[model samples]
Target: MPVWLIWFIAALGLAGAEALTGDLFLLMLSGGALAAVGSNLIFDNYVIDGVVFLVVSLLLLVLVRPALRKRFNSGPALPDRAKALEGKNALVLDRVARHEGQVRLDGEVWTARPYNDDDVYEPGDHVAVVHIDGATAVVAKVV
Candidate 1:
């Protein structure tokens, strides 16, 4: 029945919802609810407590949430399988031509072709994978 108790309960509920959603929005609301509890302690006015909650929540949503989301999302990039193979060195296993060839890439044999139609790779040549087209790796002679 107490205003502070109501605010505290709302804060706890918002925090639990934040846990489930994993987004920063509900967490900001929970911070606002805690601020409302503080306002209730100081002013004992419902209007002041509600105003404090709204202002604090909006400030957090507008300012802190974006920065937190950016920090959370902008971590180091992780490459997928195709991107991971790019620029990796492979050993030519058979005579490679513009349209046809084979290479051993990372201990596994992969179908390969010259990155450029004019290039030719002899067996025992080292090449760098340039890109993947379906199951084939387009490779260029390593230097």
Candidate 2:
């Protein structure tokens, strides 16, 4: 195959692979390959082809990436609600004896305790999920 055809084929292949991997960097490489093919076809000069490919690759990766990602991620099913739950209210179900017990948060049982504080609590106490310290919740009394 011709150099331009080879470069175009490589560009399509790289673009497909980038789509499969879900990474943005390979898209720049695909842009570079396509730019090389086009520039070589237009000018047929080694230095100008290289320069055009470099400029196009950098422009695609830097200027277009954030917009592409924003468009790609724009949807109603965004996972922002999970982040809102931090510092939310919950209720202790078991004795927070020595800073350890189970709590009921939105009807789900979660292991919780006073976060970063040395304190004791009891059942039926209201607490706030201050933070998550791994599998357990670091909660404190909501007063």
RMSD of each: 3.6, 3.5
Q: Pick the candidate with the highest TM-score.
A: 1
lDDT of 2: 0.81
TM-score of each: 0.70, 0.67
Candidate 1 regions with alpha-carbon error over 4 angstroms: 77-84, 92-102, 111-127, 133-136, 140-143
Error of 1 at 27 (Å): 0.7
Kindly report which residue pairs in candidate 2 clash with one another: none
Enumerate residue pairs that collide in model 1: none
* lDDT of each residue in 22-114, candidate 2, tens digit only: 978888889998899988898887688778878898999888988888888886776554466678898889876555699888678888777
What does candidate 1 score on TM? Answer: 0.70
Which candidate number has the best lDDT?
A: 1
Query: For candidate 1, which ten residues in a row score worst on lDDT?
Result: 77-86
